[model samples]
Target: MDLSEILIRPIQTEKADILREKNRTYEFHVRKDANKIDIAKAVESVFNVKVDSVHTVIRKGKAKRLGRFESQYPDRKRAYVTLHSGHKLDIFEGA
Candidate 1:
């Protein structure tokens, strides 16, 4: 898969911010089909930082009801990438 297509976007929530600050880990919403190696490569190339490890989670779609109709949200995959020591992405410095 193309590197650009591997990572969908960064997940910038309060919890994610805390993880980045304390654990040197960054979270991203990635393509459901992408694997761990692909995510590591994508993050290394995009951020120019060495990646120590990658952890992934797949969140199942939740069902919601509108009146009598019910529908499900799309499934999402998340990756928690841990950077190597002495490396950091400036893009998230002010975040």
Candidate 2:
């Protein structure tokens, strides 16, 4: 997969922020078909950081209903990338 297509977007929840601050880890939404290696390389190249490890999770979509109609959201893949010491990505800086 292309580097640009591997990572969809960064996740910015409160929990994610805590992880970033404490563990030097960042979370991102990634393509479902992308693997751990791809995610690690993409983060390193895009953010110019040294990635120590990468963990991924697949979140199953839940069904939602509105006035007798029901639909399910698309499944998503999330990647947690931990940077090596002294390597930081200023993704949320000044935001």
Q: Pick the candidate with the highest lDDT.
A: 1
For model 1, residues 25-91, the per-residue Cα lDDT tens digits are 9999999999999999998898888999999999999999999999999999999999998998787
In model 1, the Cα lDDT at residue 84 comes to: 92
Cα lDDT for residue 7, model 1? 88
- Residue lDDT tens for model 2, 1-95: 68979999999999998999999988999999999999998988888889999999999999999999999999999999999999888867656
Off by over 4 Å in 1: none
What is the overall TM-score of model 2 with all chains considered together?
A: 0.93
Cα RMSD, model 2: 1.1
Candidate 1: lDDT of 41?
A: 92
